[model samples]
Target: MSKVVVASFVLCLLLLHQLASVEADDQMDRTAEAKSDVSEQKIDCKAACAARCRLASRQNLCHRACGTCCARCNCVPPGTSGNRDVCRCYATMTTHGGRLKCP
Candidate 1:
């Protein structure tokens, strides 16, 4: 009877440990999700557009258009030119003239 009691106690302890591990993992996942949400909403449009327009011939026009696109899309392609495939919103925006809006 005593041996059986010891075995049952050990099983309960193992189950408790497993439950704690699962809870910790769940908490970590929640934290990571929250961080990503915050980051997605806080992209620095100014810096991103500045980097994107660094090599433009018309600096003011490039910054203005890039800023608008970045503000609306919350993203900018990685370099000064091309690579619009990286940001669908930036690539697809149109001006009143039916031309591409972003530089």
Candidate 2:
């Protein structure tokens, strides 16, 4: 191939490689952000449960049980309603005669 044609081809290849690398990085960033979001949600749920546990006067077994169940179940924060929350699982378990119910 002529020198000019070879140089042009090399440039195109470099551009394509850069684009692919950028796309890969973007995907990785998105995955990391999603993971971070989940972690934050878990922390928020735990905090909320702990606060509620501290405030309740009854100290019934159900309070701790509900908190534990909420921690274990999948939950999204409120305001983002329509998204799944741990309370739903607890409610389902209660309705279905499962072990985790408020006393």
lDDT of 2: 0.58
Q: Give the residue spans of candidate 2 off by over 4 A.
A: 1-4, 43-58, 74-86, 92-103
Model 1: per-residue lDDT, tens digit, 1-43? 9999999999999999999999999999999999998867857
lDDT scores of the candidates, listed in order: 0.92, 0.58
Q: What is the TM-score of each candidate against the true structure?
A: 0.62, 0.46
The worst-scoring run of ten residues by lDDT in candidate 1 lies at: 37-46
- Backbone clash tally for model 1? 0
Off by over 4 Å in 1: 1-40
Tell me the deviation in Å of residue 7 in model 1.
Answer: 39
Worst 10 residues of 2 by lDDT: 75-84
Q: Give the TM-score of candidate 1.
A: 0.62
